[model samples]
Target: MKNTLPVTRYYGSKRKIINQIWEFIESENLEFDSTLDIFGGTGTFSYKAKIEGKEAHYSDIFKFNTLIGKALIQNNTHKITDAELNFVLTKDDNFNYKFFIKEIFSDIYYLEHENELIDIMVQNINRLKNYYSKYIAYYALFQTCLIKRPFNTFHRKNLNLRTNDVERQFGNKVTWEKSIEDLFRKFCIEANSYIFNNNRKNTATKSSALSCTKTADLIYIDPPYVSEKGSHVDYHSRYHFLEALVNYETFKDYVNFEKLNHEVKLGKTLEFESKTSISNDISSLIQKYNNKIIVFSYRNKGIPSIKELKNIFIENNMCCRICLIKTHSYALNKSNKALGEYLFIAKPKK
Candidate 1:
């Protein structure tokens, strides 16, 4: 079974051990009525919640993630007809969907003649939308497709999903167009029944993970383990679209990228940039909500000792229990492991 939402090249996506995640949640017998993934990367937790029939809430500081979340979790699913495809892809008929290509490829000026090729891709995607959901179907191949651009992220950015660009990349005299196309077709055939077939839920915007404040029976947090490390998440650079999403309409202050610099200046954003501090705020939240179970995912990287967490929880009338999760080795050095993730389960006494 092709998981409609198979793992892609996400850096910290939980898709790696979704089963393990499910085990933790199910084993704890967490209330299925409400759940939250404050550090929703791939949003596997929230995604899983929706799949399992839970009222789920997820938030991330990244807008790129939010865009994907909106499309995958929020948007009302549309059957995606062949007519839309015809409108988007085939220019021969009345509808010339060239603008669609322009929107996504507005930044693709460097590659030689790549702009023209993007137009072709736009057409192809439009025509193909009928075969699958526009969100998952189009990008299944395009997003991960080997395109031989400068960064070499794809190994080859020129080739897209089909047609031919093998010559443009490594000059390999191989025609992978057919092979990739076949895989895409197969993926779409199976993906159609899984994700696209299901009704999507609503995803809110400009909200923090704890913003849903109406205490869930359980709350899961995987905030950045350190204050200095959050800098690694230059969300504006990584997910610039988020700046556009928030309507700080009156506030010219850049809310995404430029805002990071501001956060640095204001000290609201940290040099390292995790939201673990939200846990401290939970001490405040406990005044209103009662009998809350909290689970937090943490790594040894600069985390306060478990004692610190214990103190925080205790002060808030919660009991904190820590469980060892996994230790991952560095990619370059298999024997080296500087950190491991810890699961902190806290039950509120208040």
Candidate 2:
């Protein structure tokens, strides 16, 4: 098994603290051999579970994220070969590549030439025959798009942040200016290092956590963080560009052109429900998998506070244990103070 996961700057990704989370899971003495990561946002936690020789199942509502899970967790043996990488990176004349990314997304994210490259790359990725190969290519392409952006997000149309002549105080300009080919190749190589068989039929699915049908020895729930201050992370808005790439065939139909950012309106998922409803969402999810060991990861500051969550476990007749680990705020946040990362391990009371 590989010793490292591909680096990702995905918002709310647990890549940085997956070890801490896993250690806490271990200390709970939870006898779990298989894990279902329902909200598997970077798939790092599921990948870690796979690394630990468990059957790791990853699921997410967004197609792009599901691609990430498919590439890393589900795909145990497939790695991007040198020939595959060259095929995806190189532009082919036979394939009629559409310039939708360039025409529709011009002046929104990357430079004109960079946008053209994305058009070529995504088209080539879509053309790949193997499921794992296609997902891996998409993974590399998504990473390239993310790394080129100013905030590593598609939240705004701020191409000038990387293009305009301004004194850079923050953000890595060198990384931003890296060519699409170089970044795509680098990320694909990094992704290749993460593929290995753990001798299990691991899988990835695109589904809402509440409605996910897969059950395992342990159910890992790390829903989108909703702050008590009424602020929330809407991943669809932040990473719509990458999401569109996965659904590129129907991309034109879903484009919400009214928004300045031209974000694809994929509609509000359960994760983006109001702060009040999240508690019920949590309650319903836990009840759905109450028979299995349920491990919930959350921030102490979020809505449905740690106390509220524990109450849900009690109401469901499940004994629970909460482990708190202090961690720094996300890189984009102004406040750098450490905050509590809560992991609640609960099982149906005997």
Choose the strongest candidate by lDDT.
2
lDDT accuracy of residue 208 in candidate 1: 49
Instruction: State in Å the error of residue 261, model 2.
Output: 0.4
lDDT score, candidate 2, position 8? 80
Candidate 1 lDDT, 217-307, residue by residue in tens: 5666665544334444433333232232221221224332233222211112432244555445544444333366777666665445556
Candidate 1 TM-score versus the reference = 0.60
lDDT of 1: 0.46
Model 1, stretches more than 4 Å misplaced?
1-5, 61-63, 74-79, 82-193, 196-206, 210-215, 225-235, 241-291, 327-336
Among these predictions, the greatest TM-score belongs to 2
TM-score, model 2 to reference: 0.96
In order, the Cα lDDT scores of the candidates are: 0.46, 0.85
List, residue by residue over 1-350, the lDDT tens digit for candidate 2. Answer: 56686688888777778898888888878798899999888888899999999999999998999999999999989988888889888999888888888888889998999889888888888778888999898888888888888888997889988888889987789999788899899989888888899999999999988778888999999888788885565777898888888777788688888988888876446554578688888888988888999988888777887888899999998998888767865556637464577888899999
Stretches of candidate 2 above 4 Å error? 270-272, 334-338
Clashes of each: 14, 0
